[model samples]
Target chain A: MSEVFIFATLNGLVTGLLLFMLASGLTLIFSMMGVLNFAHASFYMLGAYFAYTISGVIGFWGGLLFAPLIVGAIGAIVERYGLRRVHASGHVAELVFTFGLAFLIEELVQFFWGRDTKNYQSPEIFDFALFSLFGQEFSAYRGFMIFIAIAIFAGLYVVLTRSRVGIIIQAAISHPNTVANLGHNVPFIFMCVFGTGTALAGIAGVIAGPVLTTFPGMATVLGSIVFIIVVIGGLGSLPGALIASLLVGLLQSYAIASDVGMPELLTLLGISFDRNHPLNDLWTLNLPQIAPVLPYLLLVLVLIFKPTGLMGNREE
Target chain B: MTMLKVSNLHAFYDKSHILQGVNFHVNAGEIVSLLGRNGVGRSTTVKTIMGEVEPKGSIEFKGEEIAGLKPFQIAHRGLGYVPENRDIFPTLTVRQNLILGLKGKEENGRWTIDDMFSMFPNLATRADVPGGVLSGGEQQMLCMCRTLMGDPELIMIDEPTEGLAPKVVEQIAVLLQEIASRGVSILLVEQKLSIALKISQRLYVMGHGKVVYEGTPSSLLEAHDVRAEWLEV
Candidate 1:
């Protein structure tokens, strides 16, 4: 039981960090541009598909290296031609533009890659188990994924806080007009930020593709969850996103791992529900059964109780 | 040398015409003030000249045509603007704010970070603090100092001392003189006629988006009717 709990925790950490990779970019873009890219997950899907195609030619390492670049370029073009044009129409228009973009990209992906899931596989080098605990083996690729996520997070923190470009970007986030008046090309900065953000999301898709399976529906499956993480962590906050990602990841992991639930609670309390009860589903629901809905449930709770999210700056 | 020349400039905020044929000039090493009431288009004049507002007519900076250019483009061409409502990056430290003011290639401007700190000791003490946490006077000082770091040939400062303690206003006056002494031309938009008369080499009293009075400080001081009709509340 303890071993199961321990493995679940480790898995949770992996999932949480993976979620952070996507959330960090979303938060960064939001802070800078004040617009949430609804199609962010579509870029991630493109990353995976791009990587799969590239890997067939030059192997996984080459695919990993080039896929994000391609995605980043595509993201920059989209910003320059699509979002920037819609921006003048106001926030709703921008949101609708991205929402439509996600649908368009999905159709494009299916047209190009087909509706079937790609046989995306982890690199042969990372296929072996790193260690065996309690007769269960953890793949080295999972370890690699965790390492990459941590490195990206650390790198992002340093780049935002310690570098010259970071300071300018940070200043631009709050005072764009003043930044322009100071002679910084504010629009150029916005374009770069948008590109970088999508690139980060692309990287997340590349690594998670093999583990989660690459398919047309992969983006739709993860899109709402990623959006939840950003909102739960506090929109436009890096640290908040980090905490919230791990929280959701671990909570879901533990829930899925545990067998305890409504039935167990009722049994402990010496109360029994009738088979004919209308709330039979609720009465019999276990932790594993509830795992899928945990994130949404938490999101609702957070919104009702703490609308700014755990670390969001109070809205003006 | 004439640092800036504006002739028959027309600007609008949507359908409402704000600056109607506004004209003004500032020479190198000279301090010129645009004095007017709240809605008399003094801010719009500077904003239009800074390329914040799209204006119709000619605006020459150092004899180069600058109308219809983007704000950053105008700024890159040696024009600095300190807006009426001081827009500081609230999250950034004072030092970082000043650093952002540094030009890309020519970083060694006329003013150093230390010079700004020494001139405004309040800023030096709060150098590490975020701009949002600073008092209004400190933010105004920071806004001015940050623009100075860009080393502009001519700066158009819009209401540098609007809502401030008397001492800070005096400090701003002294700083403006220091800026002029360093050979940087100034186009000041001010509401307080006393400060304008004391610091400005030439004054342009604006009413209804046009220059109602343009004269030397002494000449304007002697004209009671100009002050009574246009400047006085």
Candidate 2:
């Protein structure tokens, strides 16, 4: 039981950090453009498929390097030509534009790669288990993912806070007009930021594809969950996103691992329902069965109580 | 030499003509004020010059046509604008705000971060604090100093002393004088006639978006009828 708990925690940490990689970009783009891009996860899907193709020719390392570049360029083009045009139509139009974009990208992915799971695999070099705990082997790749996520977080922090371009970018996030008046090209900055954000999502796709299994619906599976993380953490708040991601990740993991459920509760409370009763489903409900909905459940509760989430500055 | 030449500048906000064929000019190293009441297109004129609004006339800066250019393009061409609302990047620290003002590394620029701090001691004390937390007066000072960091040849400042204590207003007046003495031209849009008369080398009273009165400060002061008809409440 203890080993299950430990491994669950480790796995939760890995998942949380991976989600952060995507959330960081999403939050930054949101704060700057004032638009919640619905196509962000589609960009992640593109990264995975692109890497899958490139990895076949140049191997995994080469795919990892080139795929994000390709994705970033595509992101820049979309922002320049597509998003910019829709911007004049207002926020709803922009949201619809991105939502349509996600569908279009998904269709394109299916057209090229087919509606099937790609046999994306972890590199052979890190196949061995890092350690054996309670007779269970912890694979080295999960540890590698944790490392990459932390490195990216650290790199993002340093670049945003300590560098010259970082200061300009930060200023642009809060005050694009003033930054423009200071002689920085505001449109170009917006393009770059949008591209950089998608590229971060691309990185996450490249890394997580093998573990999660590269498929057509992988984006749909994880995309809304990432949104839940951002909302739970706080909108447009980076630290908030990070905290929320880990909390959701760990909560789900622990809930899934634990066997306690409605059966245990019924037994403890001396309450039992007939199998044919209307409330039978409720009586038999289990934590593991509802683990997937934990984030959404929390989201609803948070919205009802504290609409701002944990650290969001902007009020709805 | 004329730093900015505006002739027959007309501006609009969705069919409501805000500036109706306004004309004005600022010369090198001189201080000029655009004095008018609220809604008289005083703010609209500067905004049009800054390319924040569409203008249907000539705006020649340093003898080059700049009427249709974008705001950043105009800014890059050595034109600075200090807006009435004082739009500072609230999340950034004072030092970061000043740093954003710089065009590039200060190789031979007149203003530096240190210079900004020394010019406004309040800024230096709150160098590490975010701009959002600053008092209204300090934010105004930050806005002016930030624009100055861009090292503009001609700065169009709108109402620098509109909402400040008497002491802060005095400091701002002194700063403006110091800015002019350094050979940087100023186009000040001010509501207070006393500040305008004291600081302006010349004055233009804008009425209904046209130059209703344009003269040296002494000439404008002597014209009591013009003062009552166009300026006095």
Candidate 3:
């Protein structure tokens, strides 16, 4: 009923859906290759920086189109030259390689974009407020973000489930030999899927960069959170990633919006803590302050209780 | 003409040699059985031929040197191998598993999925089920079918009937003979002398990794001293 509550919920949904976009691709790539790419978020960062660079030249829409294309091409090369070479060494080495790649991308971003957040503005057409919800203005760009994320998800779903290429990709994951036998190149297929996955992440970054603040630390901020959404949702399941993202988004959104703390609960329960007490910090702990950590806590719990993930097959 | 030729072959797991100075050959459309007791390098011989092991010496398939080729490359060059464990992709459907082996190189093979389906109707019945769910005999059938889909020029099946029911083993024996009759060279590694004798035109017995005995099935059956000496029960 309150404006603050409605806006927070709306914003939470936007954040959640965007997170699903990244997690879905990461989960699929992980399932197929058995490699958790730590550099996935770095690709997202690259997308933002590329979009920022191109928006000045070809404009916002063109940058959105071209940035992911360039980033995806780079992703394919990374898979071919970096991941494939390290594959024979073992999965752990491959994981460490991606970790190193993530670090490298951060340094590269700083070298190119500097340590400051870029002036990535929303396009002029969507600059105006769309409507008033609960006496508060709802921005058109936020609504546009929701639309774009949904469209991408729907498009990806159709491609993966209904298209012929999707069938080949799925077959490659389960029976690469069979696909190869049927006259498909398995390695090339893997490279394409890896490229597409990273590209999707890049798109997510391009779209969210303006709202989220496109700084060098953008990837670092969202990296672990995206992994939390993926692992919690269930690795390799697109729908699971979607549900988990929304669940996380809304949960954090509501927590941050709501005014609740240990002190308040303690008072309600007829318990009091002295200001000079050793556990004063613990007494004053609030949900909003710790909202960012809920997904990670859930990730740990999922790993402990259900290692296969919420909707995934074991050890995929 | 020989489909597969091996000379003074030696193979090892790490340091310990398993296949020692073994000389063997299988002609096109021929059924040559490698008959030996357990731990006589029968399985290792097949593995070496398929490029699963780094064998020391020369192996030629269809006039091409093939001792050092990768498994997929070897498979591409028309050498089909049915591993002892059956290594079926467990999570995949029976059809998916079979298709994985069909490497599209068989321009004119005697076997097709339809042909294999007709031969082993059991596989067709459970086409949608995961390979792991199949019985041991069924898994062997799936393995054989998978390899057949590849349409290899020469097939090396390692111990197809090692752990099957007697009836199932008999069916597999029949299948091998039927396949051999259709002009596909098969180098069978079998512990069961009866099954091997039923299918093989010729046989070789190995001891300590070297071929010590080679003869026709009847000759092998009749020569008790050769059986008791080189085969040694």
| Candidate 2 CAPRI level | medium
The candidate 3 chain B region of ten consecutive residues with least summed lDDT is B99-108
Clashes of 3: 5
lDDT of 3 by residue, B1-233 (tens): 98999999999988888988999899999999998888989988887877668878999999899888766677878888887877777766787666556555342556777787788899889888888999999999888887877787788888898778999998898888887887889999887687888878899998888899999999999999878876655
Against the true structure, what is model 3's DockQ? 0.19
User: Which model scores highest in lDDT?
Assistant: 1
Cα displacement (Å) at residue B114, model 3: 3.3
Measured against the true two-chain complex, the DockQ scores of the candidates, in the order shown, are: 0.73, 0.73, 0.19
Give the higher-TM-score candidate: 2 or 3: 2
Candidate 2's interface RMSD, please? 1.2
After best superposition, candidate 1 residue A97: deviation in angstroms? Answer: 1.0
Please report the TM-score between candidate 3 and the true structure: 0.86
TM-score of each prediction: 0.98, 0.98, 0.86
lDDT of 1 by residue, B1-233 (tens): 89899999999999999999998899999999999888999999998888888989999998999999998999989999999999888888998888888877445888898999999899999999999899998999999999999989999999988988988888899999999999999999999876788889998999998999999899988999998999888
**Chain A of candidate 2: what's the TM-score?**
0.97
What ranking emerges by lDDT with the best candidate at the front? Answer: 1, 2, 3
Better of 1 and 3 by DockQ: 1
- lDDT per residue (tens digit) for residues A1-316 in model 2: 8998998898899989999989988987887788798899988998898999999998999888998899999999999999998999999999999999999999999999999899998789889999999998989998888888888888988888877788898888777776887788888988998998899899889999999999999889888998988888888788888898899889999998888899899889998779899988988999999999999999998888879888887876
Please provide, for model 3 over A1-316, each residue's C-alpha lDDT reduced to its tens digit, 9 standing for 90 to 100.
4877888889899989889878877987987787899999999999999999999898999989999999999999999999999999998999999999999999999998899889998799988889987667888998988898899789888877655566557767776654553445778888998999999989988898889989999998889988888888777888778888998899899889888999999999999889899989989999999898888888888889988778877573
